[model samples]
Target: MIRLIWTLSAHTRYYLRRYMPTNRLLDEIRRRRNLKWGIPAMLLAVPYLLIASICTNALDQGAPGWLHLVVLWSVWNAMKLIIMGPVSLLLLVRARIAEAVARRGGRRDSDAGESVNHAGAEPLLHR
Candidate 1:
């Protein structure tokens, strides 16, 4: 069952990737997602959520049933963008800290009272 779902998703992605006109822009966004550009990308969710809200209003006004699909797709994309913002921020922070550490002679911090054992070279605490 899960395999079937996975295969279906793969095929759907294949077709979408092949036909989507904005594939290049999406690829660029994905490539730079962990950079400063990602923070502003979170704002893209606002438009999606607005679209979903508009479609939902239309549905309430007796729009066609198929409008639900647009609402669903908009909400889902908004959620993905919203989530990616904070995650990318965290990743950026970690990358910056690693770069800073590397610049500072790349010495890993160790407690002053810790001793390394010869057998495993693992640290042993004084306590």
Candidate 2:
């Protein structure tokens, strides 16, 4: 049972080393890409605002009470978008930070060609 557990743990570590992204990729992408909160902010806000404006215009046409209700719905949706957009953007930023940290750690591990062990001992493995 102990051997099985050890083998599984070793395999997991090996696969993690083989597949994870290196720090170089993370650094290059982070440097090249501007994380634009404005783009996402506009994306989240603009469509709903446009729809709300159109609905308001339609309501002004004096069509019916149902159309007024539609306008109200549009306004509510717009408000929801405006409120949630920032929250979503914050979540996205956090996700990127986490990804960067993982990539950096993985790259360091790969460069050292040493798995971080519980006992802080470096073991040379045959690749």
Candidate 3:
């Protein structure tokens, strides 16, 4: 009984977090109003456009009807997946390369007496 209650509470919390409009999240997006985040966000509009067109057509009671809309929605989502996969992979690879370079440079700095002492005493610079 306790486990079930906990599980329900966890699910409720997850849904709220997923759907709620948090100011912090919006503020961060506003702050990062740059190409890095902007391009992908723009790409996301494709799905919304597909949804809008389908809904508009369906409401008109067109010949092909709901089935056509469903197929289009599926295709739109699939295209989004295909388009985003490569872009995301490229971005991830770039980040990894940057991290590797930073680490390599950081090691050189650490070699120049930036390391903490093994002894209980504070680092030489800190003291």
Candidate 1 scores a C-alpha RMSD against the true structure in Å of: 9.4
> For model 3, how does the per-residue alpha-carbon lDDT over 1-127 read when each residue is reduced to its tens digit?
9999999999988886576443223233333222145345445546656775677667677645556666566565546544554555566567778889999999887765434444354765777
Best-performing candidate as measured by lDDT? 1
Q: Relative to the true structure, how large is the alpha-carbon lDDT of every model?
A: 0.72, 0.59, 0.57
Model 2 clashing-pair count: 0
Poorest stretch of ten by lDDT in candidate 3: 26-35
Which is superior by TM-score, 1 or 3? 1
Q: How close is candidate 1 to the true structure, as a TM-score?
A: 0.64
Off by over 4 Å in 2: 1-63, 111-127
Which of candidates 1 and 3 reaches a greater lDDT?
1
Off by over 4 Å in 1: 1-6, 15-34, 106-127
- On residues 3-115, what C-alpha lDDT tens digit does candidate 2 reach at each position? 99999999988885566443222222233243344234435456656776777777678656676676676566556545544554565687789999999999998866545
Model 1 C-alpha lDDT per residue in residues 1-127, reported as the tens digit of each score: 9999999999999987777533433444555433666667778889989999999999999999999999998887788777766766776788878788886643443432233454456554643
Q: Which stretches of candidate 3 lie over 4 Å from their true place?
A: 1-64, 114-127
- In model 2, which range of ten residues has the least summed lDDT? 23-32
The order of the candidates by lDDT, greatest first, is: 1, 2, 3
